[model samples]
Target: MKKKSTNNKKTAICGVLIALAMILSYLESLIPISFAVPGIKLGLANLVTIVALKKLGVKAATIISTGRIVLSGILFSNISVIIYSLAGAAFSIIVMVVVDRMRVFSVTGVSICGAIAHNAGQLLVAAFMLENVNVLYYMSVLGIAGAISGAFIGILASIIIKNITFSI
Candidate 1:
């Protein structure tokens, strides 16, 4: 039936998006740039997540984000990394979904909030692990980094969403 075919197509697209997110995560790891502060990176994989959220919906985006975290964690990182990634991705995706539904801000604004939530989630985990509330101090720096990286990823996602057409 057409419904089954559509489901199949959506599954295929989700798989491809997951692979792309993993690739982007890998590429981001390869980059030598470090901001001296911990948990600061380009968040390149977020581009796929944002696009998936807009094109497919929150459910697809959730699957893509969670899949990327688990697979990438197993391949390129450790258990701790997985924990942090899960927390960040969960928080980020939740914020993105809420902001997206509100429709007040542009995609870029939603992305920026998602990025900040991601950082905050990670920081919460880190603080708990370290048993030091001082870890919260890092937010000032991470916030700026998140805004910048999120803006870049958001712009990229917007462009892709505008240009590409998918049957699913």
Candidate 2:
């Protein structure tokens, strides 16, 4: 009974987190950044994922991250975008987890790494699926953009980590 209840609580929390991610993704999409690249944004949703990783561990974060990208893709983007989001989320989470294990960086730093990894992941997918290195032609610019976004999300994650006193 206790176990079941705990799981139910976790599911509820996860649902909220997923919703938060979707909202961020949607809002970010609505804003316009310079259109030098076809797809680029702040990755605000990643803030939640980073928090989840710290609070609930990698598995929960991964699940939430994957679900958010897939569902958001279904609602707002086409199949190609979905593929890119999935690829990016997968790669980003992997980097975030590895960095977490390293214990070398603060949450802010971790977020920065996560953002870069997200871009790298998506670019790799583009390279693999589309067979075009042109995807990377913009990576340097994207990296600079990613650093800014990552820092913003990371700061948010750090607050969530610092202020909220709870467990997964």
Candidate 3:
């Protein structure tokens, strides 16, 4: 009974976090970052993924991450956005899970890996859609952006989960 309740509580928490991520994604779309960089955000939604990974585990984090991206795509963006987000979220979450199991790095490191994976995933999708190999050129910038943002968000998630005491 206790285990069941704990799982239920975790599920609820993940759900709420995913919803918040969706809202953040939409809001992010509304206010384009002033950065000269074409496509980047603070990656605020990434916070939820990081938290979910620590609190819920890899599988739960994957589910929530994918769901949030897909729902956000459907609600806020187009099929292109869907393709990009799905690819990135899927690849990044998988890398995160693998890194997490290796235990070679701290949670922050794992999160950064996820962020880098996200860019690779998105680049792959962009290349597929554009039908051009030149897409790789853009990756260097995205990777750098991902690394910085991912590390920041990952650390933030680690801190929040560590301090919350939410049984998550």
Considering TM-score, which of the candidate structures 1 and 2 is the better prediction for this target? Answer: 1
Instruction: List, residue by residue over 26-140, the lDDT tens digit for candidate 3.
Output: 7777886746587777778888888777777777778788889778777767987787788888888889888988999987899889999988998888888889999799888
Residue 148 of model 2, lDDT score = 86
In terms of lDDT, model 2 sits at 0.85
lDDT of 2 by residue, 1-168 (tens): 989988887888888899999998788878887556667787888888998898888877988898898888888778898888888888888888889789999999989998998888887887888888876886898798788889989998898899885453
Ranking the candidates on lDDT from highest down gives 1, 2, 3
The Cα RMSD of model 1 versus the native structure comes to 1.1
Residue 8, model 2, lDDT:
83
Clashing residue pairs in candidate 1 (N, C-alpha, C atoms within 3 angstroms)? none
Please report the candidate that would top TM-score against the real structure.
1
Candidate number that wins on TM-score, 2 or 3:
2
How would you encode candidate 1's per-residue C-alpha lDDT over 1-168 as one tens digit per residue?
999999999999999999999999889889976777754799999999998898899999999999999998898789999999999999999999999899998889999999999999999999999999997998999988899888988888888999988887
Structural RMSD, model 2: 1.7
For model 3, the run of ten residues with the poorest summed lDDT: 32-41
TM-scores for all predictions: 0.96, 0.91, 0.88
RMSD, one per candidate, in order: 1.1, 1.7, 1.9
